[model samples]
Target: LFAIAFALLRKYPTNEEEDFDRLIDNWSRREQPLFIERALPAVTPNNDEPPPDYHSEENLLVFNQAIADYLVTSGYTVSCKEFCREANISINDSADKKDQLEKKWTSVIRLQKKVMDLELKLQEALQEATVGGPTREKRSPGEWIPRPPEKFELRGHRDTVTHVVFHPTFDVIASASEDATIKIWDYESGEHERTLKGHTAPVQDIAFDHTGKWLLSCSADMSIRLWDFQTYQCIKTMHGHDHNVSSVTFTPSGDHIISSSRDKTIKIWEVSTTFCIKTLTGHREWVRMVRVYQDGTLIASASVDHTIRIWSLPSGECKSELRGHENVVECIAWANDSAGPYISEPIANGGTEVCSFLVLQVVCW
Candidate 1:
């Protein structure tokens, strides 16, 4: 009975012994999940590291040696390490890699040049499309189209064809006659398009502004008429040019007009309004012809005094004189853009410079 009691008491162990048993229980509980169902099977590592990635080691060696030899020939005294760094290739001292890079770079440059050339050709083609004709369908081969004559007669004009000019953006021509009528002709077909009639007196001059949307006529009836090219409506009749308005021209901007009269005064008239803006005063005789320069800086007028006077367009002040026409100056033309001479500034010592010296950076033609 005593032995049984002692054994039962021992089953309830000492504190130190109980603590060690609890620790062992906890450790085994944590390790149980690590094995899941069971521990994994062992595998040995691969024996010879992977097979080498080398291809043609002999050829590669030959190329590397050739590069070293060529570099020496080319006077490059670079070490192999330095060459590798400079070449930016993956392999050190590899001539094949260098050759590959050279070929790739050359291909890239060739492709870039081809792109640039194609872009230039595209721009030229677009330019030809706009300037050559209205539409692709309107293209008439050179053999079919008639060339414009340097001088052509307007048979419809009973008197002398006092003025003739092309339409600004179309295949049409306009002429003013001393017989008091203005006629429009098809420039390509050589056919009469329309006849504008309103002035009782002889039509002395005709002009089309930069847009070709309006036609302006000055007449011996002492009036200037503005005609819409589309509707042929008399948009406005200017009554300011004293006596007979002999000659007229639209400014390059189409904002204002200039007219010369036998009344001895030249008037600048504003478009869209019948008001006269300025009356140039200088001529001692009747003004015969007036022209507006392309630059819009000067107004040239001819008179019976047989001299052409150039006045500043903005202030109406006389700028220069071209004095040699013995008769009434009939006509004048500026040099083409190709022939436009540059006005050079005087040198420090009073010598003249070549026209190209004062040239603007951008070439117009």
Candidate 2:
């Protein structure tokens, strides 16, 4: 047995990493031309006018054949369910096999609208390039306008996904769902990696510690659970709140946790001991979310009472309350350092009028 195993290992020395790199290099080399041929067929010079029924069954046959050929050439395989999932097409599970046919009539109408939008943008860019002038827009100093295109949608949660947090250092995201599970996903490819389950009730929020070594989640079960990120196992379940725990966050130092609950209170827990050290109560109604300041000196919380409160750490004393919101404030975050100067300044008129311009721009959009 030892001789046979050694012989096989020597004969089949793995080249998986080299093969994968070669495959990626080939894909990148073909990407531009292939995209032009398939994605922009309607605008190609040879095919100046696309078929009126571009998504008709006959046309779909051509598209499917092209995809199948590409898959074969690329050494890839996909099941029907996986293909349908990526295309966002629903499958009729109850339909008879003979009666079930590829449904494209409805999807065609929706896809045509999207294709038209892309075609317009492509035409504009093409014309701009021909003119030999700048194809980008100019903006004033400190002005930023971002309109990023959707790449892919992450699906699989059975219930509402309450919160999503990016891993501090990894290309992954943790999502808390009302399905009572925390799901880890590949942020780049939108792939569901694994599900972490322990909560008996819906999970309300999730956060990763600074080192990305652990994750903390609060749920409607009136408890908080800590999980080892590396092992994907629940390390400790901390229970203290009388009612549903709405939100949780790690202190800047990642040494402690702050949680807000429907019990109208916020509690600070010592992570090392997994014990509730202090519970601050002041919210007139259920607290929706709580966040720690960058310096870890202050904690900010929002509540169903339509007010925001700032609390001092260690002492657990409410320093100030901001009111005037007409509806529940479901989330809160401390502004980044760049916004400090503007937030602290009194409103005034100026040539640029940063504050008013921002307000008007938001309103117009």
**lDDT digits (tens) for residues 67-153 of candidate 2:** 333333334343333433443433342222221122322353355567668979999786545443432365443334322344458
* Clashes in predicted model 1: 0
| TM-score of candidate 1 on Cα atoms, chains taken together | 0.51
> What is the Cα root-mean-square deviation between model 1 and the actual structure?
30.1
The segments of candidate 1 whose C-alpha lies over 4 angstroms from its true place after superposition are 1-154, 337-365
lDDT of 1 at 284: 71
Worst 10-residue lDDT window, candidate 2: 344-353
RMSD in Å for model 2: 22.9
**For model 1, the run of ten residues with the poorest summed lDDT:** 1-10
Candidate 1 on 21-94: residue-level lDDT in tens?
Answer: 45435534644334322332234446866544333566445445444433334344434334434434333344
By TM-score, who's the top model here? Answer: 2
CA shift of 118, model 1, Å:
29
Pairs of residues at least 3 apart in sequence or in different chains that clash in candidate 2: none
lDDT of all predictions: 0.66, 0.70
